[model samples]
Target: MHKLLPALLLAAAAALPVHAALPVADSQGEPLPTLAPMLEQTVPAVVNIFTRTRVPVQQNPLLADPFFRRFFDAPQQPRERIAQSLGSGVVMDAAKGYVVTNHHVINGADEISVHLADGRTLQAELVGSDPETDVAVVKVAAEKLSALQLADSDQLRVGDFVVAIGNPFGLGQTVTSGIVSAVGRSGLGIEGYEDFIQTDASINPGNSGGALVNLRGELVGINTAILSQSGGNVGIGFAIPINMAKEIMAQLVEHGEVRRGVLGAQAQDLTPELAQAFDLNAQRGAVVTQVTAGSPADKAGLKSGDIITHLNGRPVRDATDVRNVIGLLRIGQNVEMQVMRNGKPRTLNAMVEQPRATTVNGDKLHPRFAGAIIGDIVEGMPFYGKIEGVVVLEAEPGSPAWRSGLRKGDVIVQANRQDVADLASLRKVVRPNSPLLLNVQRREGALFILLQ
Candidate 1:
């Protein structure tokens, strides 16, 4: 009877005329809660992004053979095809027609078009993009565009109600509701700098670069990646905080690239054994391991054995936290770090420094390395302080180094079966006329290249 009474009451309430005003309850004593009002103002700001990319078509190895090509009279020019993909973006500045989206959305794109909720499609120009943070900005010439207000994402709590607005599966401006699952998520390997705001907000493939807003219709995050094995939404999703995105966007707009600052030190996560060694009771921090001489860290009096607890007033949980915080700051910015030296808390101020890589021509090292440029691994670079090796900064196409399977961004960790930690060590191992062997660390994996 109780269930039936509730159903009857619900049916009676349904029969009542719907009012424009919505609250927890109406004047007739009926419960009615809705997200319609908030979504009405937020959806228009979210745009649909379509990209067309021209990519080379792969051919069989036999087809590339000179003998086979001569016999079969294969086409001289390479075959190409156009690939199309869809994603979402947010209208950050309606006046300037600036739309912010994920870098992967328009990466390698030949043409980009933005579709508005008002049935308008405008061509967009790439303003700039930072692949490390996966943040990109595009400009479109449009009118009457709506923009969402940016909210303080740092103030967001785990239980705060949030809404995800995007064009999911090309369905056009879909809205999903969820609460903040977590904040300050890092070490995901999804991006170089990952301080993601994790949420269970049904973020899917086409939802990338969409807007994640709070209940007040204010933007808190930009939906970026999902953690689903089946490519479907399994409730686990991640977004770049608007605060972080805003900084990256500013640098991209100003310099067309991110000039990341460095702390010039290496640190590892604080372990229980290390905590005991340092006589510290807490486990959440990063222990400094090395400080480069004449660097910002060295100038600021940072030393090995110091455990960093906080940066710029925020708690540092591990090495990744330290990396992400410093990676986002621009050059010449001031940083405040709180560390424990000799079991005593100490505060230090340091200015972020511009990173410089010591580069050398490959011809000076070996004949096979001609036309390649090798550089010392500097702070703020990938694998900096994590690996000891010289990096191939550039390798010209059709050059001796390129023919020897050496490409740019390859870290040569070993030469002639001997450890080559830096350029000087590499020079000691490689003889001019002797056969050369290199153990290189590529982006995907490691391999050995032998040159005669």
Candidate 2:
């Protein structure tokens, strides 16, 4: 009866009519202050971004047939087509003309333009973009523009009021308000790295790369996505925290790309079954399924089945947590990982590094590898039936490797009977004028290519 009574009470509460803001009239019969003053400051900082992309249309394969071409004279290759897209962005720097937006908003764009609030349009330059975090940096030549101030998003808590300003549905600038629904949300598969700030704001299409600010007119987040069924706003939206965006922006503005750290480990979320097998106290952590042989994780003595509990003193709730934390760290930084092995806790120190191909160039390089680009597999790279290895990223046209049936997507498994586990190992074994035998793993089967 106690449980049933609560359920009945909840049903009754759901039937109650919703109310608007409290105290429409103040005690002295004067209206309360509205958000207009704050919006006045923030809305101007949010601008519309227009982009153009040229995409080549693919032709039908049957048109390429010899008989069809000879008899009907197949039409020339399909001409390139133009596609346009629009989104929102926030001005971060007025003097330097720096603006921030979602990476996907300007992805593959050949031409970009920023539309200001004061009836001025300027061509925008893409400084850099990081798809893992879905943040991008753009620059314009304009000066004396309005800029929004970024707040410490880490200081935000659940239920804090936030306002979303964007060009939703290309309807110019729009404003919506809601509370922070949740924080530190991850594993939603929205992007390669997901540390989103969930809000109940009415975000919709074209809101991507817009400003999500607080009442103090401080930038708290960037509206990036929404969770809706009917393709309209349903009070569920996601924003990339401004702090993470700032981190990526700094790198993009300086280096034109984000340099992320690699921990050299493959991980997955711990399941209840795995938790029982490992005799864990709780089924909440990332399990190290495999560690690269010579990677930082391996050098730090991380082994398979070791459940990672924390990274650099931050609690790791799942494999996404581990990936996000490691992905954000700069290369050459040091990290401390806490893990549980055999029901005991241990700490390991590892240096975050970027994966690079051990290059063997000049005469010492293998002829079969001379024009092939190789690298370690990073996050979001697609592979067939495998997750780790030194992959052939590209092959120069008409190059020896390209002519010898070696193609991209081939994973180098062994070289001359020695293990070619990663880019580094492959470089170590490749030599000129040697009996080089490469064992490759393709979608079909394992085959070897011999080069002398």
Candidate 3:
């Protein structure tokens, strides 16, 4: 019996350590780590943006009551309609009360209200907005406010942890955790210039202009758009990089608008067939299909059929790259471009110019034709799969061409029973007072035309 008791005592001692190794308990039976530090750092810098626009309210012509007429007749002024929109913004400068947000958030707004985390709502005025970059800066009358520190977005990589905070659906101050899905995303056609940071964060309708912060609670991006058919988050979202946003914000605050430099060259993506024809090693970079006469590229000796591989030492990944880099350049600044001519890389220097605000000419007809303009079909343009025709460059507003549903950019392959190659051929076929039969191709589909 004494031997058995000794063995039992040893067994009991062995089990004691296992019980002591159990995790310590809290009130919720979990580890206690405070989120106050992160909240304190980022919350104060985030602000709620509310915008109001006044639209003209049209009178209901069906209300024939004398009482209604008498009530609304005193004011001969246009009836005022109020539309309210809401989003989020980040306080960039505490001293100047400068805030950064998406341009669409405050576009055409008559009034703006900024709500701080401290339960203070103040009036905000638009400093400036750039539609191309989708960035805007606004100002409020406040001093010594908490402003967020910006992180270098260029340092971020895929799989890095990120946090997104905003007033989604007006549900005051929501935070979501995510990982960086991608970087340097462009050609989304969402905005003119896109270098978006792709993430899986829960960015919703009201999340636009919200801050996308890193684990250190530093702003890295501004939440902008999401790819979801239902308009809600579905594990795919995009944000404008903070670096681009910062640049636009600085320009907006100083110049009241962004001045983008232009190269004045028409570019197209190198298709696989074009790559084979040009004998390119890779189907990358933009192909200079045409250079506008007297433009910067033309003056710099850039010619058609040249492939632009680099701009100012940065790699031109695609057509978007050329646009984005050029767009950020200052007007009259000299920029260096690397082009591939005859399979040899050569450098050229060109002075950038301000982009003209001219409308795109889609009509491809001669001006002498009544309300018609002609354009030659440029090969290698992205026509929706397997369709080919000469594009329409212009159709005078309310002219015979306009009434016949002849839109700009429509491809006219056959006009007046003649295959149109260029403007001269089109003019030769269609005579004045002659009935014209045409066949047009559009992005959506094709159309048959008749003129009398």
Candidate 4:
């Protein structure tokens, strides 16, 4: 009976048709498709950008000719110093000959050249660049060229597959595949308005301004930066989302500049300690550190220490999140903001205003206080101590503080025999004709002080 049962099972197995393993769909239940069609459609739009810049050479004082010293009093002679750099760009409009790239790629370049994938090389002229967003647009004199189509980057999600194409390390036309690591990542200090798409793609130096496309061959991001210690790809790469790039590109093409709305407020991230201290249920949102007087935020009744958690009903996870939303808004547009103050949440409407066009020349200014230069004692800073007094950042080289043996990072707790809590109090106590007596708190211990 057992032999008869085994024979029946074998006959049943033989009756079934032969089967082979087949590829299945992804987690979204979408079937996997060949990437060849996407790549074939997009690769032609990508171009390599080569730039040459001339910099002034600093001549050595020892190499100066004694005979020519009288005629040339200048310390250095101007010389043609050429610097070469490489990056990648994508053609946005073939008819208008417009190409988009990172501002850092072509900044200060005297000559720029674009190399197409089909062995065609063209000289490119810079139209405009916005260093705040790290975006730039260049123009070439060619029609009928391949151009790329932009996709809505706001629809992207984490774990979505993406492909990066660019010239990495001067190697032409390279491609790398990776998944979206994160979205709306900021505070990396990479750019002014950082709403970056974090990815694990192999992006290197020359890959900046290249294309980060989805499986549909649509441009979703522009490769901008990488977080690496060895100056090589370690999988942590960042890209400017296409939506932000498109907004800047349109402005650059039309007016040669980007105009961003500002609320005129200094913001800081809400730490877990601050969240607990303020009785916040969630450790999210940005806290207003300072509101500029007579600005949009001030006019809207936003004050310092107020925690902003939402804008237009959308969650503002941090200061960068608020900045990203405000920067994209147009001037005169009214936006709703939800703020938490004194353990209570409230909503306020604020009209966006134009940002100040002050040109910052990268100078570190020292605040003058009571005949001394002072700086704030920022929290969590690895400085001398945790006292609430202004530190002597600088001392006017040979001022009273310098002569009194007061050095930089010396925290001044008291001035004019009165307790000093901040720079404003220090300034008030240090009048021009008043006798200065400061009690300083050094790195070691507190010390009584007397300044002239």
- Report the number of the highest-TM-score candidate: 1
Prediction 2 TM-score vs. true: 0.71
Off by over 4 Å in 1: 1-28, 58-78, 395-400
Off by over 4 Å in 3: 1-36, 64-78, 271-276, 356-452
TM-score of each: 0.87, 0.71, 0.71, 0.68
Q: If both were scored by lDDT, which would come out higher, candidate 2 or candidate 4? A: 2
The sequence of per-residue lDDT tens digits that candidate 4 reaches over residues 120-178 is 99999999998878999999998669988889998999999999999998899998999
Q: Score each candidate by Cα lDDT.
A: 0.92, 0.85, 0.81, 0.82
Number of clashing residue pairs in every model?
0, 0, 14, 0
Q: What lDDT tens digits, residue by residue, belong to model 3 across residues 1-452?
A: 88799899999988777545635567788876655579778988998999999987766664445676677774344577799999999999999999999999999899999998888999999999998788999999986689999999978999998989888888878889889999989867678689899999789999899999998899999998999999989989999999889888878988999876767787777777887898989678889977878889999999999999888888777876777777777789899999999889899999988654322232323222347665554322333113444566677867767887787778877887678665556667765566678888765577888766
Q: Per-residue CA lDDT of candidate 2, range 362-399, in tens? A: 22357666677776666434341144567777777677
lDDT of 1 by residue, 130-207 (tens): 988999999999899999999998899998888998988988889999999999898777887888999998899899
Model 1, global lDDT: 0.92
Best by lDDT, which number?
A: 1
Candidate 1, pairs of clashing residues: none
The C-alpha stretches of model 2 lying farther than 4 A from their native spots are: 1-27, 57-78, 272-283, 341-345, 357-376, 379-452
